[model samples]
Target: MLRIKKLDIFVLKSFLLLFAGTFFICLFIFMMQFLWRYVDELVGKGLEINVLAQFFFYSGLTLIPLSLPLAILLAALMTFGNFGERYELLSMKAAGIPLLRIIRPVVLFCVFLGGMSFFFQNIIGPRAQKQLWTLLVSMKQKSPEVDIPEGVFYSDIDGYNIYVKHKDRKTGLLKDILIYNFSDGFENAHIIWAAEGKLELTADKQHLFLHLYNGEQFENLKSQSVISRNVPYRRETFKEKHTLIQFSSEFNMVDGSFLDRRSDIKNMHEISVAIDSLTTHADSVGRSMYSDIMSTTYRGAVLTPADSVKIKTENIAVINTDSIYNSMTSQEKLKVLTTTENRVKSLSTDWDMKSFLTKDTDNSIRSHRSDWHKKITLSLACIIFFFIGAPLGAIIRKGGLGMPVVISVLIFVIYYIIDSGATRVAKSGEMNIVLGTWMSTIVLAPLGAFFTYKSNKDSVVFNLDVYAAFFRKLLGIRQSRHMFKKEVIIHTPEYAKDIEILDEISKDCQTYLETHRLKGMPNYIQIFTNNKHDDAIAEISKKMEALIEELSNTKDAVLLNLMNNYPFLSVKAHKSLFDNRWLNLLFGIIVPAGLLLYLNIWRYRLRLEKDLRVIIKTNQSIIEQIEKQQLYLQK
Candidate 1:
């Protein structure tokens, strides 16, 4: 049995609210995207209210799987971001609650969401997609609303291009109308000119009724007779005339059962069944084609007992076709060559046709296989995105929609790009479908793990200062120090001890310079394998810092100003290449990278020598200033 704590309840409540809101927001966004893609189809079809509602409703249902992952990602980010911003996360951690424990409730909820996503994708999504796509096709096939504008050719009507010069808005009359009708064929076109006309839909709405006044109609007689030149036509003038054109304005739906054959409009079980059937059909077709080709190739061949013995003894007779062709008459040779060529071409064409039979089956198998993997991959994406978003939010410590929204969108875009690119490649048969389908998950799982680890350890993963310092050290950039004279002396420097320490530091620097040749390149082996330590530099730095701390309290402005001239030494700058011994050894084993690291180490070694030189010169100068002050005081 599981017990629910207040903390768990608090976390669940916060996450659930954000999840619900973000889910709908994501759903709405994806639905709008769907609408934008098919807006042209839905706009002029004059679909009923119920039909339009069903269209949007089915589209939303199909988009639910896509929306779920992004929604989870945004919600997780916002939930944890709000917690971190308000220091609630910090307080929980302060109470000995780990980051993972704090996020336990949300993680469980994400798992539940994943299951829900799987259910929808495997069950409801297929049916909705079928309905949605069927409706889209119906909408696209449906005719546009009849709205003929003035001074424009209205070609939306099938087989007719009607140009209206003017129209009476109140009377619903078209003036100076010119029409081209090629319903039968272009050669049998009918051109008409009418002084006035009016168009209206019939009662059944399956035909357009055109009433014309003072119209002259010209009907081409070219199609009536097969005359090559001087084609004749018939003409008629009428005071009033009516023509019935086949134009269906009523809304009609197409048979949606055709969409059942698509891979996307199938459940996991259906896809599996499809894949198996296709594979079996492809195999049988391949075996049959192979047999046919083999039989055709060896159609007239026979192996005698002597030829079999020759085969066993590896002494088969070789025929010289050139000599045989030379022995034959020209007509006989041409007859044989023609027969062989025809046989070869016939076999090639037959093989091509047979190969096409299995090609479609193989493609169907691949589609079903890819779709099967898609259901599982989409389900796993929800849980994976939670790990990424929650830890990333805690690291950024930014709450509300502003920062989290931007970050979530960027991450989701990256995921979408990878998923879409890989899916296309996989579907094209250029890549293994399973690997391509899982490529996005494989790429992001490690990132999620890294973020979670860093968040749990409370690492400053995005601290710019830390990164800047590392790069500065890597590039051997010099840093300056600032020192000031104290207003009140808390512990004034013992000038005698300070002088002695300065002398000691200068001697140690001189000794180190003499012992180590810092101008030369670092040893490759030592940089990688050996852990190089500079005790002299470390000790000198320690003494220099201690002496500076004492002298900073000095009332003498000159001595205080001179303290700023001390070089800030990096005590471990000349240490081993990395803190990890194994990693250092690995780098050493990689020759090209080891050479680069070797040169970088040499640069650090050179920088260390310069720092020591500056430290020694500055130390001597400070010592002379202190001695001069003492000498003047003694006088």
Candidate 2:
């Protein structure tokens, strides 16, 4: 039994759900298209429904290795996205968990999955596929006796024309059966005629037994009179009646020849040899040459003049400069150069350098020329996706089905496109196989790690300052200009005028309240006055609270408030007071926050839709939001 830790389980469940969902979604879409195109032909050819179903089922099995990595990648992204959105990653990191530690289980799981995929690709998958196709072909070519219609000739089955007057469903009997045998030439063909026949299914259902009574077998022997044998037979049995189909035997095992033809083996051999030489005492010149060859081979297929010539010339120059004849005259140096050139030329010619280079290149090219490599490449993609998804999830922090899905899809699409293009180039011998296969992972891994690192550190990648700057740029708007002087200028008369208006309202309200306190005033007047004051206070409080909330939420409360209050200030004033430059610089910090929010929403929706779909399909009661959360947590 496999024991999964709590955290591992969490990661696995998340990854599995994501992987299964993505795989099935794609599989369903593609399978539907495939089935739609072939279903009619299959049915028209009188194929058994069971066999057709098995064919599709096996087809999905064949596709598993191809889809597994994609599933892993998508699942990793979704799982990590959800974690980031939920702040689980942040919480873990805050608890002193390393990013590598957090991802350890996921990486291990992917390796395990990759191994399983290899087993399927090399073992079970091919066999199942071969069997399915064999059955399908057999079914298509098989003849039906009872199902044959009257008058209309049915020739879907190869080399046979079958016609029957009527069929009895219960007895599985046909009234009149006519089978035109075309196995031999039509000129010398025979006809099978039966007055009444019954078809019985064999135990395995692979063969059918036809029992005929009172039938005549007519034979047309070329250059002889037509021979008709009338028999009053009680029962005549036909053996091996079911269609005999043949399937390719090669699909049973991995082709040894295919593996031997791969260039990767050669590369591996060279690498192994280099490692061995490096470990033990070896000639420095030979070692250097091998090392250079390995590097060139690893980088790509072709090596131009720029690759080896520069290093060779530099080495020769250094050797000559350090020679014992260095103190000799310029003429002596010329003699040494001539001698060195001749030696090098002789060495090159004797070693057949061109052929060696060509051989190495060919070996490198052959290494990746198998379909098996595709499976391996896809399997390894799991790691790439995990890195990308985990960090992205943390940054986005909004893990529902909306933006997270969109972002995940976009990222995966980019990775897939690059990977696929690289694979093609590699197959064409334009690039090295290992480099091409791992290219997408190399490019995206760092990006994922960076995001995860920042997220773990509680750093935002995008902020409101960026939004403000963006808006300003888009609207072609500059900071407001305060045209007034800095010094406060107050006029006594204007201040007095404002004070007079305030005093008048205050006095009137006080006098009215005092008068009402003594007299039994109208109920309507008292109610109206109380309502107006309450409403005014409530409105003021609401406005203040809203502003306070907005400011609290902002990255820079003081600067944001200032910008809101003073719209006519110069750009310089805004920059000075609010440190707008820093704000602009910190704008990227909010990107992670926004992305987190977006992913959270996206994942939530996807989860909800998935749950709802499941419920609908199972005819279960609608699940509440809290219940759904519990279910997700439990899984």
Best by TM-score: 1
Per-residue accuracy of model 1 over 252-351 as CA lDDT, tens digit each: 7899988877999999999988888888878888888778766656643334567657766986468566897899999998998898889778878876
| Model 2 spans with C-alpha error above 4 angstroms | 1-158, 192-196, 200-219, 224-376, 399-439, 446-450, 453-635
lDDT of all predictions, in order shown?
Answer: 0.87, 0.55
TM-score to native of every candidate shown? 0.87, 0.41
Weakest lDDT window of 10 consecutive positions for candidate 1: 296-305
* Alpha carbon RMSD to native, model 1: 4.1
Judging by lDDT against the true structure, name the best candidate: 1
- Deviation (Å) of 492 in candidate 2: 16
lDDT of 2: 0.55
